[model samples]
Target: MKKYLLQSIRLTAVLLVLLCVVYPLIVAFAGGFSKGNGGGEKITKNGKVVGYALIGQNFSKPEYFWGRPSAVGYNAAGSGGSNKGPSNEEYLAVVSGRIDTLLKYHPYLKKADIPADMVTASGSGLDPNISEQAAIIQIKRVAANRGLTDRAVAELVVKNTEGPLLGMFGPSVINVLKLNLALDELKK
Candidate 1:
């Protein structure tokens, strides 16, 4: 029993160091090798940092493409979803409000044409990407507002659309911030 007790203590100590200490150090080191060198990828424009590539930013103007609805109002520190299920009255009401607001801005969009992501907040409430369909749906309004051709804006959306992981998994997505940045560059 004493030998077993000693073995248990050794195992616990070893695992604690491996998991609690060494693991984090390795992860941090690996992150340093990544794009932002352990920090998030900063998206810069006109020699100024606009936002992070991995986080969402609120863009309400008609000329800018809209991103997913954020439950936390795009507050990164307060990132979270509404936690209400589809059947929840409050959740439905919130979705309804979003739909109404979207319609007000995009009078040409049919209810069915609105992508689900456009009206629903992602789990993180900081999703920087939206479905290609979501981006495409806003092309007309965005083009009209920016005084650009629909074809031009649609081409921009196509240019910014990212394929699924490894070209074979998940639906295509568009980083809304990146797309909007490209749009601004187009005007230049």
Candidate 2:
């Protein structure tokens, strides 16, 4: 009985070490060395690191397209949604405020023109992209601010748009940082 107990103890310790330490270390190293988008780092032009495509940024100007509503205000450290149910009064109040703000900036936009993604926070507060339709809705305001033709700005939006993952896994989206940087480049 004593010998059997000792064997069991040794087996438990070895398995724990392998599962908790060795397995995690192997995964970490493998992920670090793996290729494919470098964990979604943003590519920039003109030798400057702009922003990560995976994390959202706040763009309040009329000229730049806005990403989804961020629950934590685009804070990566606090990356989570409000978790409020759709029927919650607090959620309704928050959406109402967002709608008011959007209307103030875009008086020409009908209620239907405001995409659902625009008024609701994503599951993560750090979403870095917006639906392609959302970007299209903001094109007129952006063009007016930069004194460019709406058609010209729309072309830039098309240039920055990214299709669904693997061509079908997700909806078409536009990276906010990339689009804004391209807008700045237009002035150069």
Among these predictions, the greatest lDDT belongs to 1
lDDT per residue (tens digit) for residues 135-172 in model 2: 88888888888899999999999999898889989789
Q: Lowest lDDT 10-mer window, candidate 2?
A: 34-43
Per-model TM values vs. the true structure: 0.89, 0.84
lDDT of each: 0.92, 0.85
TM-score, cand. 1: 0.89
Instruction: Estimate, for each residue in 1-188, the C-alpha lDDT of model 1 and write its tens digit.
Output: 99999999999999999999999999999999999899989999979999999999899887999999888888988899878887899889889999999899889889999889998888998999999889878999999998999999999999999998999998898999999999999998
TM-score, candidate number 2? 0.84
Badly placed stretches (over 4 Å) of model 1 are: 1-14
